[model samples]
Target: MRAGGTSELKQPSEEVQQLLETVKTELEEKMERKLDKFLLVSYKTQVVAGTNYFAKIDIGGEELVHLRVYKNLQGEVSLHSHQHPKTREEDIQYF
Candidate 1:
């Protein structure tokens, strides 16, 4: 599926895809908001010695706010978000 006006959606392994979907559903329900798009970024790090999966979300095509669902080594998952800086002088924060 296409997402966020970005490149075509990257296909993940079956296990990873299932995990991603679970995370997405939980986030949508817990936050009580619908995600308009999903962008997946996956890669392996030699130094870190594990795979990383991230689901970047876009809502309403504004690009002003976004959420990231991250799965790291040890099968730990976490959710974080970022928002565009309100002012040019302000720094962007990822959390």
Candidate 2:
């Protein structure tokens, strides 16, 4: 096909190609950041079901606070404002 042809063989303009490339690059960076954050949180946090986490949430007007359950390195579950940690078996109610 001839250069800059008007047929189906024609290629996209430089401006369009650059815009697409920029968007792809931006999306990749954004996803990478999000994945990193998720990995960090997952490694340092416990995997509790959605229902368990939602049940602890206390929403008061514009203020929003999440109540997340975390397990220690020794596999002990704990609740906020509690002095002592409880064993996994004792934390069934949170999950």
Candidate 3:
């Protein structure tokens, strides 16, 4: 489509592909926590004006922690932490 007759082909190199594979594997391993009691808040949707995400994790039988992830106006992902402690009088809510 250019003035020159030759055309340029774009293909990912093997080394680049291998590096991407390695990074993917590392992310998977880190996301898969071995500990029994832990919460993971992953921003599923891309950072936008009004992106919403929800996550729930139960430490013990009664300990429940629910998190809501959202994107601020600046397009930054913000995690809102909500904790329901067994003995605490009031639930904790913090960013």
In order, candidate lDDTs are: 0.42, 0.26, 0.37
Model 1: runs farther than 4 Å from truth? 1-9, 34-51, 56-67, 82-95
lDDT of 3: 0.37
Task: Answer with 1 or 2, whichever has the higher lDDT.
Answer: 1
- Indicate the residue-level lDDT of 16 in model 1: 53
Identify the candidate with maximal lDDT. 1
In the range 2-94, model 3's lDDT, one tens digit per residue, is 332212322434432332232233333444533245433221222235543333334444554444455467655544433333221223232
Sliding window of 10 residues with minimal summed lDDT for model 3: 1-10
RMSD, candidate 3, Å: 17.1
lDDT per residue (tens digit) for residues 1-95 in model 2: 23322112123344323322323333335335321111100101223331111111112223222223333456444333211122212221322
Q: Worst ten-residue run, lDDT, model 1?
A: 41-50
Candidate 3 ranges beyond 4 A from true positions: 1-36, 40-48, 72-75, 86-95
Selected candidate, larger lDDT, 2 vs 3: 3
Q: Write the residue-wise lDDT of candidate 1 on 1-95 in tens digits.
A: 12222233344455654665656666667557777754333311111233333333333354423334455677776654333323322322223
Which model scores highest in TM-score? 1
Clashing pairs in 1: none
